[model samples]
Target chain A: MEVALETNAVFVGIEYLAIFVWGLSGGLSAVRKRYDLFSILTCAWMTALGGGLVRDTLLGDLPPVGITDKGYILTCLASGLVVAVAHPEIMRLKWTMVAIDALGLGLFAVNGTAKALAFGSSGMTAVFLGMATALAGGLFRDLMVGEVPMIIRDKHLYAVPSLIGCILTVIVYKIVRAGTVGMQWEMALDVVIVAVVFVLRMVSVACNLTFPGAVDRGGGASS
Target chain B: MEVALETNAVFVGIEYLAIFVWGLSGGLSAVRKRYDLFSILTCAWMTALGGGLVRDTLLGDLPPVGITDKGYILTCLASGLVVAVAHPEIMRLKWTMVAIDALGLGLFAVNGTAKALAFGSSGMTAVFLGMATALAGGLFRDLMVGEVPMIIRDKHLYAVPSLIGCILTVIVYKIVRAGTVGMQWEMALDVVIVAVVFVLRMVSVACNLTFPGAVDRGGGASS
Candidate 1:
């Protein structure tokens, strides 16, 4: 029981860090669009918190944390402010942002799965929620900025990486329960899943791997 | 009991019509964007069905009807095809589209309230749901196109008109239940509410009415 509680706390910390990275990316993107400061902050907030808000509302939770918790809002605001002020330097740190975003994706996948399980969702539902948590924020940001969602269209393993991470997390949880592994081991297993997702995403991007095309140019059917 | 069922059926019909109008608007917008036929159809479908999808998911309903119902998708597709083939000439009838949109808003607000009440939601929640149903589709469209959500930033009475219509619908339902009005009169009440909402929105637009400004233009405050 103590071990489970400790694992939960670690999960919460990862979730917060993921939110911060996502918020920063969204803020920078809004700035690129020449939006006013208020619009930039709005985009940051939505990108950081929108997925969780959708998840909570769909689960019939009241007053979603994104709307009710001052901490979450403050985190978004602070991240946005930092990015806005450090825009020149941050623009040169593309690889760093990509690395952090990969980490954010892995952590969010685990957090989403755990939260869905906590809410008593079935395995399929939990997997969907995990994917939603990891990808929906980026999707929202892309849609808000009039770009095709990377998960939906880009030639990279974005959604696949998140999906793999979620599947790994769920599998690990089930295996640990079946094998009677300790709570510390479960946390370690989660870390391994995150590493797998991060590495897979990086390798896929390097190799230019992509999902089968869904739509072809020139109005022809592809898939 | 017969009267109650009839009233519910009328509300449902009005809701469907509202959906059709919103769907048409979405279809027209997609055509204007010069998206290929499939992309136009997808955008139109999302615009028409996105609001109700959000509402139902928030209420814990699964696989929102917009995804599951063949008729809904068909309607959106047909609307898109019509607008796409009609070309730029269709854009000339701006007043027609605006009038239809206003009527759709009123119908959607009333339907949202009725649905919420049927689901046993509190009165305040019902009202919010009504406004959400009326505005969410347009919000999704704007967000997808990388524009500030007109409902959130514009000073127009867009959402306010829906709010009034929803409140009036709920009040009428309550009064009718208390036997203060006959069944025929209760039906008339819904029509009156819709008319009032349509007029209110048109007047507000014509008069350039807007909400009080909340954010300062100058960079005085931190993000």
Candidate 2:
């Protein structure tokens, strides 16, 4: 029982850290849009919470953790507050934000996969859900700000990396279940997978990788 | 058999129109962000398809129509093409975009409710799904662009209006089934509900009657 509690604690802690980083990125983005402080905080909170909300709702949960848990909301609020207070200094260190954002992505990808598996979702569904959970928040942030989501178009490998990490996590879980490894080994596997994805994403951005040219098919598309 | 075919045609036609308008808004928004044409098209497609994708996936459907249907993809592509060509001129007439957006919202709200019912969802869940379908695309667009989602922070009554329209549609369907109303009356009810929502949205926008004020539960209060 204690072990289970500890595991839950570890996962929740990592999730909150990821949420903070995502909130920071969202706050900084809103600053670029010249939104007032209220709007900035609102955007930050939404970016931090939106993905988890969608995941939980789809999984038949209510009042998603991001909204129900004081800790999650507080973490986002604190992140936004700190960024708002230190905007000038933080804005100057663009690389710091990017690094944190990448780390958050890695953490979220792993966390989402683990969570889905814990909920008894199949491997394929777990992987897809993980990728969705990691990317959805950023997608929401971009849309709210009236910008195109980088994940869908840019070949910077954001979603791809998340997918890779999630697949690795699932494989590790299966192998460990076969008695080939232990809990510590599983943790190591997760770390390595996340690290690989983080490094790959950084390199992709550095190399300015992008999607291929467009094919124009004509007409008015509506949702 | 002819009646069923006619129903299918009407539903498909309205669905395509809804996708077109939603996609157009997304494409135009991407253009405003100065994204490349490929990125614009991607955003357009996501905005057009995102809500339906969510709705279908939650309903346990496979290979969502937005992904599997060539017609849907073509519609998105066409919307992007038109937006790319006409954006400069259209940028000046924000009201036109707003009107079309409202129309799309209403149509999708009704369509989403109908689809949810067809999928055997409960009335409450159907209404929720309907509002989600109507608003999710725009919400996704705003988030992708790093803007505050209009549904959350803006006082435009966007989601609320959709909810009302959806409920009205559901009630009409129920009445028709109870023999208190005919099929034509049910269809007319849908049109009336949509029109009411659309007009309400336009009036709200023009009057600038946004949500009253910020609720300060925690964090620093905004001015």
Report the interface RMSD that candidate 2 achieves against the true structure, in angstroms: 8.5
List fnat, each candidate.
0.07, 0.14
Q: What's the distance in Å from true for residue A199, model 1?
A: 11
Name the 10 consecutive residues with the lowest summed lDDT in model 2 chain A: A214-223
RMSDs, each prediction? Answer: 8.0, 9.4
Residue B174 in model 1: lDDT:
79
Model 2: per-residue Cα lDDT over B51-143, one tens digit each: 877777667654355555678878998988878777655556678778877887888888888888877888898888888788778777777
Task: Name the best candidate (by lDDT).
Answer: 2
Q: After superposing candidate 1, which stretches have Cα over 4 Å from the reference?
A: A1-46, A49-106, A115-129, A150-168, A184-223, B1-17, B30-50, B57-93, B120-132, B136-204, B207-223
The digit string of per-residue lDDT tens for model 2 on A73-120 reads 888888788778887887888776677677777777777777777777
Model 1 / residue B36 / CA error / Å: 9.7
The i-RMS of every model, in angstroms, reads: 7.7, 8.5
The C-alpha stretches of model 2 lying farther than 4 A from their native spots are: A1-15, A152-155, A177-184, A213-223, B1-115, B118-223
- Candidate 1 lDDT over residue span B154-213, tens digit each: 556787788799898778877887888875777688788889999999988888865432
- In candidate 1, which residue pairs get closer than 3 Å at backbone N, Cα or C atoms, i.e. clash? B155-B210, B155-B211
